[model samples]
Target: MRRDDPIPLVVDLDGTLLRSDLLLESALAYTRAQPLRLLAPLAWLAGGKAHLKQRLAQAAEIDVTTLPYDQRVLDLIGRERAAGRRIVLATASHQLYAERIAAHLQLFDEVLATENGVNLSAERKRDRLLQQYGQRGYDYAGNSNDDLPVWAAARHAYVVSAGGRLQRRAAALGNVAAVMAPVAPLQQLRTMLRAMRVHQWVKNVLIFLPLLAAHAANQPTRVLAGVLAFICFSLCASSVYLLNDLLDLPDDRRHKSKRKRPFAAGQLSLGIGMALAPLLLLAAFGLALWLLPWRFSAVLLAYYAITLGYSLYLKRLMALDAITLAALYTLRLIAGAAAFAVPLTFWLLAFSMFIFLSLALVKRYAELREARRRGETAQASGRGYFPGDLEMISSLGAASGYLSVLVLALYTQDRATVALYSRPQLIWLACPLLLFWVTRTWMLTHRGQMHDDPVVFALKDRASLLVGLLFALIFWGAS
Candidate 1:
């Protein structure tokens, strides 16, 4: 065990050299490509994990370049290579992915991975290494308890972990050489909350629109129902957001800002996302069924169903994506009406559809602009949009927004308006306000200043908030 010993430095792949798992990555990629075959993984798993990995490796096309590699591991390999030591990559990941990753890094002199129905993990990995290098003949670098057997057999152990617990355990083996700690937990609770997209819960405010339109806000029971419905809808939406992030991992990794997201950046494990999504969905439905009316529960179910569809398929279909987004927004209003036991007015529905549709288009337009800025000439990744379609989207969005304003203007002259307002003419002021806000929104989108979500942007924009306040005041004066 001299300093110049020629013992090979063997490194583990998943959780050692990389911060993420290839098995989960390949499975998600396969699922995203063929969403209809989601059950295929279960059937494949019946053959065992090795068989599953082989099948997924053949089915999914993973971009190895975009993977989250551990820089500490890379630096270790670099220093070892400079010292004239042989470097080997030994992983339990499928051979296809392991080889691809090895080739991408171009540092490994040899690779040993799961192949031929033999999963190279734990005891199997130890046996394979003993066969190739003999007992206590090589230095091993690994993470997780699964590597304990291999570490026991190696001459020295290099523990790669975020915390000291694993390092302490590895030290018990009495051959611990070095510990390479990656960026530790940055408050995992905060990361999980971010993955849940709690900020986007502001969209659930739409659930109170029905109570406001029906002038039932003064009714304590109806107001309470609205609050409950908001909670249920927000939970459901957060579930969908998690699922969407899981599915959009590859695309998000290529985006500038999206790459920093918890899942895409490998700050959170995909297993956690997979488990939490359904739990949140169940909680949403449980709350709706137990506390809210059955009608509200039904609306919530429909909302979840539509969102699932959008996440799986509709979001990639050209105009349908925007239309579905608008429908989702309008469903919030319907949920509010159901919670308050109030009928949705035709005027309100029409106005919401047009306005939300315009906002949805703004979202798409902003994405396309971002792609153009990134110099991507092809279709927007994970979307059915081209940068060339920006002009058409702008036109359609502006027209839809103006149409909403027109709907508002016509509503002011309706018999319903005369009954609801003491001075109906004051409602006319809202039209110009709506028109101004919509025009400014599109203008910002065209100038590439719009956030990826127009609704979220509106919540933060100063002019948008001012317009909203003035618009609310006009409605109050009219009443």
Candidate 2:
């Protein structure tokens, strides 16, 4: 095409130029920052879609630099602009976000976006483009069903990150200029699974500790109840994980590995995640009320409430966050006891709190170590600790771990231990093993080889696994 004959290349914002939706992004940010004002969005929606967008735009601020942009689309836009094409950013997203994105890229010659009471989308977008470029006089780049009407009216279609069916449909419209391949189904599935954090269900297995400790593991009825409780806690835990990710978006984006998370990376829409989290939580409580005893359900509710509180506010408090995390882990044990109507003794609870607190501190130490490795000297993002506090964290964590071993040793002298184990002295071997494992974990953290999640590290490490196996054998022989 000649320089004088270049058609304006109009690009859609959400899912076209960007991999995420601004409306959902803004809404989620608003909900997270002002949870009590949640109904404000619905009230705005009652006015109109444009009004809703305007209100949310005023309330929420997105870090444009962190937004995931389709690299291929950026390259295409760059090439078109270099060839003197007049690039137009025409998005249904409110003008507030659209203008910011346009300003960031500096590629859009003109920006046409929703403002005032009219949501500029679909046929509305098509009409506006026609008014400026005339019918079939402009090229449009878009990536969803909402863009089909605009594509039909455009001179050419540029499909960005659209599935095969969408590309075929766009082709049938007779103006397929180009198609950017979508992410593979298997890859998307993997991302979604990671987002849901199925692997973290390992933590919920702590719900069986009370049954095992009380020697009720062999009872079929108690075992069944414990397993059901485990499921409920797993679901509830997943919901909290999702919420944490949503709230930690900015900090996660700044982190090395967390930036790849579904919500933070823009692989999953914030709207879908916001909707799915509540459903998972509801399903968890439903199982609790239907199958578990009232006490168990109450414990589960308390666990959820405490965890939700941790995610919202407590997580920022340095030592308090670690202590709260330990309590959360101990609550799983309490939940199990409640579920199976088993007695949770003071010794077991004390041992668990100390051990889990150590692990929680290990998680923080690893985070600070990573920050230091990356040359970060200020306070860690979304955390109260600084890199300079790593030494103290290590000291406290190691001390906490040893205290748990001491608790275990003290438990051996209890009358209950003597009654439960014919050869209670064999349990002494487990303490040394526990000590070695804890020492090794702290050493790994010091060496910067530890994962930010100590439990995940334990699960993945061969040495930790062997130590755990030895403990199981020692306990089994004593029993």
Candidate 3:
């Protein structure tokens, strides 16, 4: 080590001083946070490390409260800090979270982590380290060859684990100290699968199908009630999603895609997610009451019953599994109407089936497309589709498009709808336009741009916006 007083100690965040990467843990924390990117590892196999890193980084997210860290490791850091060494916890992890860990540990004299939107990696860490403490001489600890550039640049190095690939890389470097810890076991497979976000049941908010269909029909109170009902359902649904993610943390780790989730990746602990779940449920139920004080709690109960069943066994059955989900979605629309004490027309129910069936098919298509693209067999695991069925998906999508339009035509022609509209004839124009819009929406999905969540997509897509605005204008004008 170079001669200098008050040495600076640098530490890596993931697989170093800390137990696991918090970013991965949180990103995979949701039951539906998994959208795509299972194919990125295939890219890795094709020697697209940089591309894989880029894709994985997009998937990276962290909820600090949920992150896991051994108390013993924290104590080690605390004692080191008491010794008056200038301790720095540095890593390629996002700076916001790295700083959070540093603050929680409260032992680091300085955090040499990524900050100002820069990651501490290779030359980046080296440059900052050299510029900041080169004249002072410092000790740095890390765990990968990726850490080599900075380790070689440091005055002294603590090479933790000198036997793995990282150890071989450290062999050529002088000033290396040998200290290796036993590897922590991988997260449980079942827990990891839950983390993969296969069942994002809460986004079923679009189930306000009946109310939206009769939006302009002089049923403002009823429409508002139904909308509020769906929103209530959404909050409750999200609470369930959080709980499922917590429960499935163990299973999620077995799959390549699921291992990156918060619990499975060892970033977030099961306890925190579990603790957070009930609080969310409380808030959700409270919101439900505020939205629909007229006894909408029953809907929440039903949702829970059906979803818990789906999570336990329905999800594992091939064709019936996804169909169960479709039924659940349709049920939400029905429940919304029932919550508002509004009766639905046959057309309204049929429209719900058409739209949801299309969405279900599209979801399957996206997942299968992702599987094929990634060379993963997961889509075929308890799934009914194969790569050769893309054309069938398009056909099914077209049928749904036509059926959705037909449902709307029947709805508009109905006496209730005709009475609701101020200019009922102008409303007919909306049918073909809506049909085109629906087809276009699915086309975008087919092109791989369908954001995983359709409701969010409707809110985000410009075309969906225009179509919606036109519908609103005609409906309001007619009323």
Which predicted model would earn the best lDDT? 1
RMSD of each: 1.6, 1.7, 15.7
Give, for candidate 2, the lowest lDDT window spanning 10 residues.
Answer: 1-10
Please write out the lDDT profile of model 1 over residues 1-479, one tens digit for every residue: 34487799999999889888999999889988998898999999999999999999999999999998888889999998988889999999999999999899999999999999999999999999999999998999999889999999999999986467777788999999998865556677789999999999999999999888887789998888888888999999999999999988888999888999999988887898999999999999999999998999999889989988998889999999999999999999999999999989999999999999999999889889888887788998888999989999999999999999999999989998799889999999998889899999998888889865888888898899999999899989877
lDDT by residue for model 2 over 1-479, one digit each (tens)? 55665688899999988888888888777876787787889888999999999999999988888888888889988888888889999999999899999899899999999997889998999999999999889999999988999999999899988888888889999998888888899988787778889999998888888887776689999889978998999998888888889888878888889998998988987777788899999999999999999998898899889988888778998799999999999999999999999889999999999999999999999888888888889999878999999999999999999999999999888999999998899999989999998898889889989864888878889998999899989988888
| Candidate-wise lDDT, in order | 0.91, 0.89, 0.64
Q: Sort by lDDT, best first: what order? A: 1, 2, 3
TM-score of each: 0.96, 0.95, 0.54
Pull out the clashing pairs in model 1. Answer: none
Q: How many residue pairs clash in each candidate?
A: 0, 0, 26
Candidate 1 lowest-lDDT run of ten: 180-189
User: Residue 338 in candidate 1 has what lDDT?
Assistant: 92
How much does candidate 1 score in TM-score? 0.96
List the candidate 3 regions with Cα displacement exceeding 4 Å: 1-231, 247-261, 286-295, 377-385
